[model samples]
Target: MSQIFENLPVKVAELPELTPTDLQPIDKRYLKVLLIMQSIIFTLLTIGGAAIVYFSPDIEPTLLHFAYACAPTLVLWGLSAALTLKGFKKKKYALRERDLLYTKGLIWSVRTSIPFNRIQHAEVKQGPLDRIFKLHSIKIYTAGGSQSDLSIPGLPEETALRIKEFVLGKTAEDGAIE
Candidate 1:
């Protein structure tokens, strides 16, 4: 029993030795698609605000009143749009020998790494806007809490599939008999 315990191997899971500088940025078309989507939503919201000012019976249609109502939305929209555009530039991901690394954000940056050995599954997702831009996102799920999972967006469809396959292969390889 003592000999068996002494011979047992130990495995330590460390984050992949990769840095933000080593990561590759996402496709440029993603930024354009996001801008278009935001523009459409902005248009709708502006129209809705205008309708509220025009149709309300009790409130007078003063320019100042309209400005007060619309100003905050416009400001928030502008800030959000600007941050989205800048955020995409910083978004990046990479597949390493042991895990996948993803980094993204504008003001508050975040970096996440999911080990291939611990991954339970990989999924590729695309929304209407993503379809229009030929983009896909890969979601990697692990055994732990929901926060441990990683979602990498703005990948080209082909790239997303390639990454998905690679992760699946790694998972299988880890489970195979030596």
Candidate 2:
């Protein structure tokens, strides 16, 4: 058994270096929407926390309790705001010869490249918040999973539609469309 393993050749696949492309950034309006949504959520949580602490008979209404309630919310708000700004700058997408690349992240960056032939289908989606701002996201499906192969959010409605059509066109060309 040991001799059989020793005779086998080892092969390691490595990803190639990414070439820079004219990546399109999502609309600036998305930033405002994100900030507003985050603010509302954090504000509601802060209020709820304060109310709970104030009503607890066992917990004295001390400065510590007050600070505990406010400090976390404030800190989270600051961190989230910073991350949102940083992430907005990092979010961009580009179409290559036979693949599409979507790059996003603040701390741990992710760059996904999905080949045209691998794309099973593409769709445009909008939530209430997205509709309020006329923004949309694209979901690209592939063969391996139920979840989307890629979901690029914060795109303008027209841009999202364009991308969807482009991906579908490519799929049809490659004879991959069902």
Candidate 3:
């Protein structure tokens, strides 16, 4: 029998930039919240499952079963958190003259390059918890995504204002991306 293999598309790597990131580290506390929330969900699911399997007599009970069930979530969440944090470490998410690059990811990192010419509008947002944390999210609008608005969380109020001014200025200057 002849062996057959399919070639997969490969993404080329980008060269390291000499510049630095504009924003501060996207506080690891966010990751903590995510992990904690996921673990809580896992716990709740387990509780629900326990309620169902309370009187089951068909399947054998083994530590392996529980481990196998939770292993995928643990591994996936662990890897994802690790990578996202790592990307935060290496790259700076900031706005440039031509594009607004919001880069975040690990092995499969993403840098959404929103050219100023594409900007339609910009906004600043804050929430209850944000007031407590003195943080806000600067939302940028383009015509690409649903509302063309993207929000980056965990920014200080001042920083969010700065981003808004910057985006608005760029939009006025370019006047093409819309």
Give each model a TM-score: 0.83, 0.82, 0.61
Which pairs clash (backbone N, Cα, C closer than 3 Å) in model 2?
none
Tell me how far the alpha carbon of residue 167 in candidate 3 is from the true structure, in angstroms, after superposition.
1.2
Per-candidate alpha-carbon RMSD to the true structure = 5.8, 5.9, 9.4
Q: Per-residue alpha-carbon lDDT of model 2 for 90-141, expressed as tens digits?
A: 8888877678888989889998888888888899999788899999989988
- The C-alpha lDDT values of all candidates are 0.84, 0.84, 0.63
Tell me the tens digit of each residue's lDDT in model 1 across 14-109. Answer: 323466567888889889888888989987887788778878997788998789768877887899898997788788988887778998888999
Count of residue pairs whose backbone atoms collide, per candidate: 0, 0, 3
lDDT of 2: 0.84
Off by over 4 Å in 1: 1-16, 19-21, 175-178
Q: Which rank order by TM-score, best down to worst?
A: 1, 2, 3
Which candidate leads the pack in TM-score? 1
Off by over 4 Å in 3: 1-18, 21-24, 55-91, 126-132, 144-149, 176-178
